[model samples]
Structure formats: structure tokens, C-alpha cells
Target: MQRPWVVATLFCLNAAAAGASPANLLPVAQKLPITPDNFCLGAQNVLKTAKQVLTDELAVLCTGNTATTLFKNLIAAPYAGTGTPALTQVFAPRADNNARTSEIMVAFAMRIPKTAVNTLLVEEKHAIVPYDSEAQPPPLGNQLANMKMSFQFMEPPKNEGDADTTFALQQTVDTRSVAVNFKDVSNHELRQYILHPDNFDFFMAGRTLVAPTEQFKKSVVVRGFMTDPADATKTLVVTVAHFLMNSRDQHEQLVLAFSNFLTTDVSKLYQEQIKP
Candidate 1:
């Protein structure tokens, strides 16, 4: 079921409102394929629905993002679709223990079913991809970070799975700031990995897990796929991420990197794999 809480962060990006929509003005998602055709998921569900993965120990300041602001500001003007995606980044300084909240709400156009798309996501991600989305087809061993689930690399997804199901992603991330040395680094702990799948919608959320020092590592990712109203034949794959970066100065670089990761990289691989 595409519950109100499914696309927790993405539900707020749409503009069309049914007559029953409340006038309160937080962000209200319009009727779309993934969303119930005639009703709203309600503003209360936007930006605040809590999940078990975001545990109590996560940093208070580190956990928050600019979802409300972006949602509110986007609707200030008319929105036809999830147009160019709204984004914002803010850093909580010493008072809040130096946490930077960087987030983005973007969408990709695809000609595929939500289930197919999501399955590809989990499948492609779970395999090895030394670099991009396309993992060399069969010799998967070579690209698999030496078969490590939690490594100091953004290579590709890997997991310890069984015949029917897979477990959480015990993966590490590159946390060193560009402000620091220019080499690649992955000194952080494992990340929070969650994949909430529905037959008609695609929504997955994950982040870096807390470290041995009990430091905050809950950087969140929220994504879903919905039908494009403008072109019913196509789907609108939306991604909303709230990452805790090292510094606010890394905003530009982060944006560029995320943009590539958000659309170009995965989309290209998706298209290529579907060919006969």
C-alpha cells in the first residue's frame, strides 16, 4: 500500500489539491498514481512522520532538515509538476554541535512501472558496481569491495542475503569533508538502510548509522515513483534526501554529486538494462 507515510518527504512536493484539502498550507501533494487518486495524504504526514530506523539516539540537530521550508516555499508560486526540485542546506554550528543539514527534492522521468523500477533499484544496487550503476554482468566478485558489506567505498550495493530475502545494508560511507584533504575517505560507521517497497510505489530510506563513539549518523534518503500527470505513459521518479554533511561550504559540490547520483547515473543504467 502506498500509505501516507510511504514517501514521507516526497508527499509534499506536489501542487494539485482536492476540494477537501485543508487550507492550513503546509505542503499538500496533488493526486497522482502513487497517491490516492482523489484525496490528500494530509499535511500532518509531511516532513514529520517518524520511522523506527531514525532511533532516539540520533542527534536532535543532525536529524532535522529543511523539508517544511522547501515545501512551503515551492507552493508560494504555482507548481505544474515537481518541476526542478526544491533544495536547501543549512549548518548548525557549535551550539548544535556542528551538524550541516543538506537536502534536495528532485524527480526523474522514466517509462516504466514502479515495481519494475524499484526491483531494478534493489537488484542493481545489491550487486557490485565498482563505480557506476552497471556492474560488470557476471564476474561480480571483482567489483564487490572484496565482498565487504561495510566498506570505505561508494562502489555499489552488497549484502548478506538468503534464498528469499535480504538483510539491512551494513555499509560504510566516505565522510571526510572537501575542506579536509582531497583523498577519498570512509572512516564512518555503517549507514541506516531501509527499503519500503509497494507494488505501485517505490520508496526507500537509509543513512549513515551512529559510530562507535555514539556519534549521530542518521542522514536520511526518501524516494518514490509516481505517474506523471503530464504524460501518463511515463513515470515521475522522485528522490528526497536529507544528508548530514561535514560543512556548509560543501554545498555546491554535494549538489553536483547528488544530481549525478540522483538522476544521470541510475537512470542511464536502468535504460540500458531494459533493452532487448
Candidate 2:
């Protein structure tokens, strides 16, 4: 049965059945140490192709049972879209924010053909304006993408002890699987930001905020590369996992925005030249 609905009005996964794969396996224990410079750095790291990202300072999230469970989900059906592909996401079963931390993973089971990805260089200056840009005219993301992009403000969890919370620039469109706040770690460098796909390659200007929004935060790295496979098609795979604090109040609305941003705004951003 194909039913596209949100779980707890938080996650909207129109995904395929789950299965494990031998070819896509990685040695999780070999992950190295990586202390990113900023939140964007951390989020960007998570967005790398599975193999490159599986091992690193963030091994704790990718090792042991977590690694096994992740690969199984990754092996599911590939998302079949158009000249450009859309990500088919799978949610992890481990939903726990028991500690001051939470793990948030956005896994996409995809088979991107080398030809499918059309990388274009986009400007980054107007990528992220101040959070107060609401009063100003929205800037055009890219002439190619033709997107008048804007930013969203973030509200930290209210009940998680008083930490002098204020409005910080961040992205909504929540996959509120978990909530986390490194109240101890202060990376002030982590501010409002995003790198539109047009600024990179074959990708949608997924209008969703990439900065730390209502829940989780990290590097916002997303890409597709040619790989090795028997099929002459694209040979790249992607895996993303993250941790976010719990905020049901901000949950439903954020999720709805994320869905609308991707399906309505993002899906139409790029105009692909049909190859007949």
C-alpha cells in the first residue's frame, strides 16, 4: 500500500519497502576524528556521499547497530523522478532524545545517473541575508533557478531549561524525529546560511532553511557524483543522519513548510532540457 502521510504530523515519508544490501556496506569502525569549524561544516559533512561520510569524527552516529540499520534503509528502492531526481527519504527507527542530544538522519535511497546531474555554478552572496530581510524584497536565488528565496528564524526549545533563548536565523521544514541542543558547545559562528543547488550542481533549490531552525542543526552538504556500477547510469549514493531537540509546537508547521518547499517550490525550481 502506498500511503503518503506524516507520522505524528512530523514526518512525511512516501518511501519504499526496506531491505539490506551487501554492495553498499562500509567499515563503520574505521571512522576518523572531525571537529568541524561551524554548524554548516558539520551539516555539509553529513551530506557527502555515504562512503566518504560514513567514517569521521562523527563515527558515534554511524557505527555499531546504527550503521547496520542505516545501510538496510539505503538499499531500498531508488527514487525515479525526471531529468533531475528527487530524494526518496527513509526514517531511522532509533528515535530518542533522552540525553541532551538527539540523532536526526535523512536517508535517500537513490540511483543518480551521471547524466542526470547537471552541475551549475550559482552565486552565494545573496544566499543568506540577515534574518530581518522580511521587511526587504526577497533576492533572486539564481537566474537559472528563478527562485526568490528567503530565510526563517529559529526558536530553541522553551522547556529545556532557561538558556536565554532569542530569535536566531535558521531553517524550518522540520523532519522532527528528534531535538537536541549543545547548550554546552557554543559555535557562535553557526549562523543563518544555505548553499543553493544552483550554486552547486544537479540539485533543486530546496527552499527549506538549511540553518539551525526549530530543532536540529549541522552542516548542510548535499551533492551527487558519478560512481562505479554495472549500469551505465549514475553511480552515487547519499546518507544523512542528524540530532534535533523535541518541539511539537514548532513541529507540525515546520514539517508542512518543508513539504511545501520541496514538492511545490523546489520541485519546480530547475528547468531541465528534455533529451529525446
User: How many clashing residue pairs are found in candidate 1?
Assistant: 2
Residue range 208-257, candidate 2, lDDT tens digits:
22345434444332322222234533433333423343334444333333
Each model's lDDT comes to: 0.32, 0.28
Per-model TM-score versus the true fold: 0.39, 0.34
State residue 55's C-alpha deviation in candidate 2, in Å. 6.8
lDDT of 1 at 175: 30
Q: What is candidate 1's lDDT per residue for 145-229, written digit by digit as tens? A: 2211233333323332201122233333333332422223233222222222212232333333333222223344433333444
Candidate 1, residue 113: how far the Cα is off, in Å? 6.2
Candidate 1 segments whose C-alpha is farther than 4 A from its true place:
1-166, 170-179, 182-216, 227-234, 248-276
* Ten-residue stretch with the least lDDT total in model 1: 36-45
Candidate 2's C-alpha runs over 4 A off are 1-69, 72-76, 82-104, 115-228, 239-248, 259-276
Q: How accurate is candidate 2 locally (lDDT)?
A: 0.28
